[model samples]
Each structure stands twice: as C-alpha cells, then as structure tokens.
Target: MTLSENGDLWCDIRTLHPAGNHPALFLDRDGTLIELVDYLSDPAAVVLIGSVLEDIWQANKDGHAVVIVTNQSGIGRGYYRWADFHAVQARLYDLLAAEDLVIDATYACPHPPPDAGGPAHSLYRKPAPGMLTRAADDLNLDLSRSRILGDSVSDLAAGKAAGLPVGILVSDGYGARDAEAARVLADDGFEVIRR
Candidate 1:
C-alpha cells in the first residue's frame, strides 16, 4: 500500500482476504465494552454497560470479527498485577460468553507515560496505533473495512492514524474533559460520536 502525502497509512482491503467482504469490529475494552472503574482487579467488578452484548452479537451476525484493543496503564502504575488483570479479563470473557457475545481476541498495552518512568512512552499505547497495527498484522484484518469504537479522542486518533474506515466514540465512561475533546473531534468528522 502507498502512503499519502498527509502521512495516512493506506491498505488494499481486497488483498486481506476475509470471506464475503466482512469487516472486523475493533472495540476498546474498558470503556466501550464494560463500565470503567478505578483499576478494577476483582473479577466481580466487571459489568456490561448498556447494550454492548447485543451490539457485539450484531457485529458477529453481520460477519465481522469482534476484537478488543485496550490500554491498561494500571499494570505499569503498580495498581494491579498482570495476573490480576487476566483474572478480571477471564471473568469478563465468561460474562460475555454467558450473553452469547464472543470476542475474537484482546490486545493491550501495560505501559504508562514517559514521565511516569514506566516504559518510556511506548508505541503500544492508545493514540499511537501500535496495538492496532499489531492486531491487524496478526489477524490479517482489512483496516479499510474495519471500525473502531472507543471512549476517548486518543482512541479515535489511534483509529485515524491506523486508517480504519470508521471510528465510533462512546460518550460515557470517559471524564468530562475527554468527552469535550471527543466532541471537537466528532464535529471535525474525525469520528462518529455515539452515546
């Protein structure tokens, strides 16, 4: 794929080779799929907000692979261990399974900001598109046909930088400040704002 002068990454969707022209649905885990909490490590704290299950199920029915891309800075901040995060994720998977919503895969970044002295502003974090790029490579996803639903502008920015066809923002879970920033992005057509 050739890069545009604006530095937007481009790809040929027909070459990706998914059957029947299906698209992959990329979702942000914490806020888009479940209610955001303060570094939730407990398995019981996982809760599906609103119609997430139905939405995912619909995507599946529409012939899309449902994947989760997330950033878990709590691990780098020492607020929760990776093992605890996995336990919580396992419970979350079980809960989603009970609702008949199957997530194809989950990708995450555990690093924090460079100022925090964690991982030095790693590329895997949101707004960098590292995780999304890795997911596309591993899954052979067609970025031009895929969609990203996130709760912050950073998430939308990541989607944009990665060349996703659609970016959706969930208004809840994010704080007031981020929501306002998302509004600006939505107004600019950088993403579709959904509440």
Candidate 2:
C-alpha cells in the first residue's frame, strides 16, 4: 500500500504481471463490496456483499484484473482517520481472502466531495473519473472493455467518464434509490449492468 502526496490517496497494488490490455473489474468498496455502513470506521462492521463475490471470483478465473475504487469521504469529513480506514481495509481483505478472492489494486479518494465551487479533479473523487483513469494507467487496464460495479450514480458516472464500456449497479446500498438516475446514463452510452 502506498499513499499519494498529501496523503489523500491510497493505492494498494498487488498485480503480479502487467498484462497491459486486461479488462478490469472495478468495484466500489462501500456498498458494492462490503455492505454499506455510513461513515464506516470500524473493522468489525466490515461485511462482504455476498452476491458480488461470485462475479469477482469469475472475473479472477477469467484472468481479468480485480480492482477496487472507493470514495472515503469519512476521512476527509473528520469522521475517521486514515489509520481507521486501513484497519477496515485489512479486515475486508482478510474476509475476501477467506473466500479465495484476490484484489489486484485499490484506489481510494480519501477526500470529501467538492463544494460547489471546488474542483473535483483535485481530490480524485467519484463522479470525477480521476481515480478510475489513474487506476487504469497504473494497472495497465483496458478501460474500453473494463466494467465498474458500484451502488451510486457517482460510481457509474465515473466509470462512463473514464471510458469504461459497462457499468454495473448492485441493488444493495444506494443502488435501489439511484436506479432511475443511473439508468439515464445507459441511454447516453455504455451498458448498465443492473443487479
């Protein structure tokens, strides 16, 4: 795990070989991976979203890179520290390991969403595409064929903006609430994988 300058970005990379053209399965950490817990700062609260694991496992079997991209605003909002986030992440990895899952990399934007006048790019926050694009470059991903699965419109929108061809919205977390809005993006471009 490495921290970007200013310590607002967390990059944990474990890719053994750089395929350079592999399609990635980009998963959102909060609702899409573990069950959503608002401002989740406790490792004990970490629970895997059981259904998504099958897809991730299959992606692994298919030789696709598995990466997690998340917006951890709780760190920026003063609800938690980076250390807390790391503890939770460690627990998440342990749980995934128990299921025979391997994550190639994780890109977390620890900053909160930008204010109306603030530039989103500065923080690499979701809905901005910075994190996705950066991860693609770092992991040698094929964004044109990559798919991002998440529970928020921001997650899907970021995938679309980063040139991903498919966006998957899990029905858990905020998915049920943002369904209509997320579907609206499907009409614009990219396939929306509904769960």
Best by TM-score: 2
* lDDT for position 12 in model 2: 89
Tens-digit lDDT track for model 2 on 1-195?
A: 888878767998987545667888999999899999999999999999999999899999999999999988887778898889889989999999999999988889877766733345664788878888888788778889889999999999999989998999999999999999999999546988788
List, residue by residue over 41-91, the lDDT tens digit for candidate 1: 888988887656677888878767777878777877889876787788789
TM-score per prediction, in order, is 0.82, 0.94
Off by over 4 Å in 1: 1-22, 186-190
Off by over 4 Å in 2: 116-123
Return the top candidate by lDDT: 2
lDDT of each: 0.71, 0.88
Candidate 1, clashing residue pairs?
A: none
